[model samples]
Target: MTAIATVTHVDLATVQDGGRRGLAGIGVPISGAWHRSRYLVATNLVRGAEDPRQPAVELLAGSMELHFHLPTTVAVVGPAQVTVDGLPFGAGVGLAVTADVRVVVDHRGPGPVYLAIAGWEAPLVLGSAATDTFSGIAGTSLRSGVALTGVAGSGCSAGAFLRQGDDAGGPLRVVPCEDVPLPVGPWRVQSTARSGTRMVGGAASSSGSRPSRPVVVGAIQAAPSGELIILGPDGGLTGGYPIVGVVCSADLPRVSELEPGEEISLQPMDVPAAMQAFAVAERERRVVHPGVLGRDGSRRGSVPDDVAPAK
Candidate 1:
């Protein structure tokens, strides 16, 4: 109802909450934040809770600039350079902002970054605000000069600032299939989008033509040409290519951060190990500090390595 900020510039940014669930059977892609862990962190930084219902700004490419019209607080998660009124702040820390302030997020590289504002709101479509770039079903891409309106919350609370891990490197954990062997070779990442990630540098073990079957996020399919594809959040509901393996849920977020030309191997993991890994990740996200902001509107001492010191 009230204008809080306006987008001065953005490249491939979107308003995303939790994806539209339960509608995948109806031929809809569960398009949401590309990295779930990052999204949860961003949510907690601003609102003091990991409520997926609250929308956050997802920056997939390039940089973004926002001009605030009212006083509020914001937090950026993942890798990026965040500047408020020309003063630099690190990612994963809350910045109390005021009217006429300008916040800029510059894409550093590799993974996507998230921006969470206290009481940020967006128009919901079918119970979600996530934009499926492939289907365009729930939302649309953000562009320049778009005014963002939200009911600014009273304040933010002390939340966690997690230092990003080196998940992108190392062998990707997977639940392997005995029937279909995954193509071997430190596969090189070719490109990535919301739909899927294409990779090169693997041998093609021809699966021939088969019936198209249901596919889920993290499914790894192999083509006849030996190239591999990993399904992303907005991947198709069904796939026809032979499924060699499913990336373990714990490692799926790492897959999202894998950059082009990076070579990766697959490490087969059992169901129990995969579940344990996921639980460990969940627990790590719950760690919080007593405070995140100082009285002078500067981030407190508990800053992560990626965020620059406020100056």
Candidate 2:
């Protein structure tokens, strides 16, 4: 493997790809990047296209430093102050560097920051490079002196999307799980991890343990302890607690960006609305890299010739 860069410093980061999908039956979580939109934006800024399977550094919090072994281009997306070789550089754009150059990112924020190298490669496990925080599956602990392998960068133009927080600042839309309605109020985020985001002091009430049932990401479970646990990308496959609702895919990004002590509100909607909301949000996300072909070989947000576009 060709050494691309060496880690000099890092705080709570992981190599994540699209993650292991369709393995939940064998007991595996879809432990991939938390904020899909931001992750894609970072990849596009570096690679000129969004490949979910492409590995990127998922910086959760704090700063990181790296020394390049080879000349390459990289992109840092999200809220952060980035500097290369002691010179201040702007985030959300591709930055070219020479071998032995030092790059530093100071990111201590509520949401995650994505760092995508142009040709960075990661070892794949279960058809993915993502680290499962809860299960410790395919995990890589980033530390100093670690040599990362990748090819030379095929640089792209400066392109990225920086979405800091929920600019809408509205209630998170939720779809009731089965017939159980989720209690809605001003909920305060207590704690968060890749496994789940725990919130308390809402209208949510405690419930007795039910039979272990299938659970997916974004599931809102009402625990016996009276805390609401919203499952993250690395959350468990099945849960014993009562599931009151599931956060809509459109709003999952907001859930991923929740910080401790931050107020979160939930608004229940019907299944059709949830689906429509997701479709609409996905349509908007393609603007991050307009005209770039996605995995399916179609232009981002472009309607197929065979099918009618959504009204």
Candidate 3:
């Protein structure tokens, strides 16, 4: 068993995995990683098993400082800049971090940065170890001075992996749904406290003939406030917002990389192109896990995304 001490000033991290599934029909939100792509990438980088046992730390935003008590592997998946003991460390590759070295994350990218340990050690809730703020399931957010336990292992081979769909520039490719007016052009991200999902600008809203419940992840829906909200992994399974369009499944991971107030564009992508995109992400996923992670409720609470970049 190994314990990594949290040496920070706030509760900004949580243990997440394939969220607790099959329980959503009972009124539970299917909470999981906001971006499944990065979750798979980071977890697999550390050779983390997709089973219920091994869970990873999902950093929603800001900086994190940790002191490892044992030697093992860990990795950050996303656009985050990582360093150990003040030396630059790779973000998407597994690295062996030894005891007492400080691992720091400069999370300036769009999505949450995942920190995967070599093995599982967290206790389970509803058959999952994910921290769900909406459900009050987590004993506490990963706060300063708390020690984390895990079984250390020599993670995966040393190599770096790249994010998919970067060549298309900054736009998030999307496909419009029938009977819905797709919001076009650049949208600014607003501060929303809900776990997993971030609210987009108030471009279009309607009292359309859509139910205010049973929304799925990635469903772009019109909020009653005339604002459109994009659901993430831990997104509400049911909401009253009318479904307008969906961000192509492959682009969901890229959505996580988005930064606050960062201008984002959603380009129309057809079915064939969408599937091809999904395949690209899926291929990167296969490099680590034999199967996909669970997708129940692994929701993240509103962690501050307002951290200024390190000087």
Best by lDDT: 1
Which pairs clash inside model 2?
none
Write model 2 residue lDDT over 118-137, tens digit each, in one string.
77788888899899988887
Q: Local distance difference test, per candidate?
A: 0.79, 0.78, 0.64
Runs with alpha carbons beyond 4 Å of true place in candidate 3: 1-11, 48-53, 154-157, 164-170, 192-205, 270-272, 284-311
lDDT of 3 by residue, 1-311 (tens): 55654455433667787777788788666566666766776666666443333577777778787787777776676657788889885466666677778888877655577777775467777877777767675533577887777565545543234343334266777777766667764677775433544556646646655555676667777776765677775567776666777888888766666666767776778889999988876764533322111112121233223211111
> What's the true lDDT of residue 153 in model 3?
57
Q: How do these models rank on TM-score, best leading? A: 1, 2, 3
Ranking by lDDT: 1, 2, 3
lDDT of 2 at 193: 90
Per-residue C-alpha lDDT of model 1 across residues 151-247, encoded as one tens digit per residue? 9765486454654463556799889764866665778999988789998887747567579888889988887887888999899889778888899
Q: Give the worst 10-residue stretch by lDDT in candidate 2.
A: 302-311
Which of the predicted structures, 2 or 3, would earn the higher TM-score when compared with the native?
Answer: 2
